[model samples]
Target: MLVAPFPPSHPLAWLDSHAARRREVGLRRELRPRSAADPMLDLAGNDYLGLTGDPRVIAGGVDALQTWGAGSTGSRLVTGTTALHDELERELADFCGAESGLVFASGYAANLGVLTALSGPGTLIVSDAANHASLVDACRLSRARVEVVPHDDPAVVDAVLAARQEPRAIVVTESVNSVDGGLAPLRELHAVCRERGALLVVDEAHGLGVVGPGGRGLLAQVGLAGSDDVVVTVTLSKALGSQGGAVLGPAAVAAHLVDTARTFIFDTGLAPASVGTALAALRVLQAEPDRPSAVLRAAAELADAAGVPAPASAVVSVVLGDPARAVDAARACAERGIRVGCFRPPSVPEGTSRLRLTARATLTDADTALVRRVLAEVLVPVAAR
Candidate 1:
């Protein structure tokens, strides 16, 4: 039998088409490398405590580099587990009032590890509608039935868990919504989970350094920190101003992740330098318990300047509705020597494009005043219009 010749198709032609579509939709993204010595006031980064450049944090990284070399050099189960890693994990778990902890290469990895390890086929995972992309992706990869409930709605989550046919169920949420800085009702969620015999996993990425007493996070604030049914995930990069993530919960959960989490088994361990830096930053936070409150105050000030409601965490979101308007507003602020995050879809929903301003504990009154002036001149007109 003779087969007709197939029509030729260009594999890479779709790339240009997609690029054009993104540009047309005002969704094209590009990287703008920033200078280390740039004088711009930064309100875009997640260095909540401003310890990323602190001398103590720098010294800790340098010391670790000198002692353990630059990298972990292997996976945690291989040759990567160092003394610094163990120490950081222990201290982090203790700080959060958890029984044990396991560190991962990134917060994304930590979320992936814990969710996948704790849930599988025949399990039900009830997630919040406004969870971070990492959690959304984790749910897709968990091989479990996932039900997305309304954001911060414990009733919906409880109903979903109660109605599930799966014998084991997990409820996952962020302690603080990353986009709008809304606080989750952890106590209510935990109660619902307990009544339904489900486990609660709270991602404390935003709450770790910006909420609760001494920045112990929302879980701790709600008296669920050490609960057996509650597990927590946090990023060292945000609050600790380091470069790793961790899962904090019962020792059994940590052990389970170590044994079953592919991200943990196949991925390289957190760097020794990051481990040391995070340790130092945690100590600094413990000593200077007032830093978290400073961050909240700064956020409130930023929100007030933007003419938005006060934030519950270190994030002040100014929604401008249109993507182009949001971009222009962010650019205007940048031109005035203030840097802020311009979030467009799909970072936020359509028609909800926003300027995401993050607060740092080290931001001075002068910085806040400058930010206020810039927002007044740039954001106010756009928001009002």
Candidate 2:
């Protein structure tokens, strides 16, 4: 029964103790299984236009599955490329006003690809403090000298870029911050980059199909859609109600990514069904251009009911003011047949703990009212907790 003797206490053993602590602090995370038919008001997902379950979109996926089979088989360079991928790229670029577009397996991959390929050892990356985790990781992996600046501060960006001695630099930001749904001052940021001869990269994951006129996205909405100096990334899983992501920018930038973006070069291509579903969703947006407006109205109405500011995008973050209360509030909503996003410290900025509810275009009048009622009832008590 003899084995190598060691102290009962070790660093690895601390993981279990940490889990217990998370449970006590109400910060533990466990996957909640759901049946396909689970009947709950879903405000925690990113299916903004609600095409995720639309008959037309589902049919498109089914057709793609039947025609293309289940797996992509290999990296896109080998067996994964299809005419559908090409068509999606073309339509997405034209709609978003980018000269070209490159699709990725996910928005995370797309952000990493753009950053690594465009930046090198001496590149200076000035990123917003509120940028998504994906962009933050990209900056870290790019080997660029990175400086985190205050949220939505164009003046801070200008100061950073001016102070940097490196001649080659890139400015990164999110058009709409996920938790707070606050819009960035894109034009001012773009102008600063222009003045400093730096590149501006925007992650528009939450803004596409929810911000621009006709849902073209934040860049187009802000009149920077096709600019040669700006590069933008978007997630199809969001407002599109599909899966995958894309980067839109100059033709040269797209070409450079194809050459050096490790994610695209090494990872398997997105599935055909995803391509088809996203295409269907984009067409849905085109045919019914008013969905974005309707969703905005619903969001505004819901915010008013909660006595908080309306969301700038499809995301609405109800400030719960404390981490433990935020978790409790989310659980309460789930108990009442509503689901919402729960964010706490570390996931969110240190002080901002809130219930992040995403809006969808297909939310019926009754459904939205239920959302307001359930969310308010669950959270109003948390304000004092």
Highest TM-score, which number?
1
Give the TM-score of each candidate.
0.97, 0.96
TM-score, structure 2 vs. true: 0.96
Off by over 4 Å in 1: 1-9
The per-residue C-alpha lDDT of model 2 at residue 303 equals 77
Residue-pair clashes per candidate? 0, 0
lDDT digits (tens) for residues 1-385 of candidate 2? 2234334586566666676787786677768888899899898888888889999988888888888887777777899888888999999989899999999999999999999999988899999998889999999899889999999999999998999988799999999898888899998999999999999999989988888989887888878889999999999888888889999999999999989999998999999999889988888889999988877876787677667888878888887766788888888989999888899877786557888888888788898778768866876677765
Q: Give the Å error, residue 301, model 1.
A: 0.9
- Kindly state the number of residue pairs that clash in model 2: 0
> How much is 319 displaced in model 2, in angstroms?
1.2
Each candidate's root-mean-square deviation in Å? 4.6, 3.2
